[model samples]
Target: MISGFKLDWTLISPVYCKLRWYGLQFGVLTSFACTCLAAIDQYMCTNARLEWGQWSTADVAHRLIIIMTITCLLHGVPYLIYFNLVRAPIAGEISCTSDNLAFRQYHTYGYLIILADAPLIMTCIFGLLAHNNVHQLAHRTVPLVNVL
Candidate 1:
């Protein structure tokens, strides 16, 4: 944004155009994946089952975060491939876009619809489960711990 908007630099470079698209998708997809993972983690941590609770450890969370980061970074590779500098039909004005027809469909329906909404739905469901578990904690009997 700063490079393009603030600096008013021309995006004639193919590498810059590709990297810009990749970076945008990477940031968005990674955050969505992490948010869903966090909700799932919270739900697991609040579960009464020992095994479920065991899955919510800091080590597990860190590992999952790293895995998701790599996954999201890789996911943006298609965007980098498909996105490029294109000339408009009207006035021959150059703009960054994908010329691939199938990719355009996927970006519209698959990415914009399914990939985007899936996380929102997952986050809502798991977040509500975690929230309910937290609220019900007071009524449940606490396990007595041996203090040091």
Candidate 2:
């Protein structure tokens, strides 16, 4: 009976660990993406050029919504495919794990690319651009009084 209990514990531990690990991964990725996107939107709204045309706030919001939706879907599909619970060898026990090693690797790489690398690069690029624009604007002198 004691050995059976130990076997049950061994079988259950992996499932719990996988659940916590993947849960943290998903949570961190989602939150990071959201925060970065929001910061990007805020920076763009304040510093964007409207030389050709003007965009309404609603239009900008819609575009952002579409972008976020696409990003989530792209990141989510691989996770859905590879992350799942499987029946363990022990009867009535299950384990949470990746369904495919290749898919899991792909998902990890994709997460790093989409959630970490891309966002960092974009934020830095846009931040520099916005800073430059603001600096140039501040330095430009406007005539306060008309010279006859």
Estimate TM-scores for all models: 0.84, 0.59
Top candidate on TM-score is 1
Off by over 4 Å in 1: 1-10, 142-148
For residues 1-148, write the lDDT of model 1, one tens digit per residue.
6555674222477788888888888888888888889889989989878889989889998899889888888888888888888899999988878879998788878888646789989999999998888877745655433332
The models' CA-based lDDT, in order, is 0.82, 0.61
Question: Model 1 residue 58 lDDT?
Answer: 90
> What does the lDDT come to for candidate 1?
0.82
lDDT of 2 at 137: 57
lDDT of 2: 0.61
Clashing residue pairs in candidate 2, if any? Answer: none
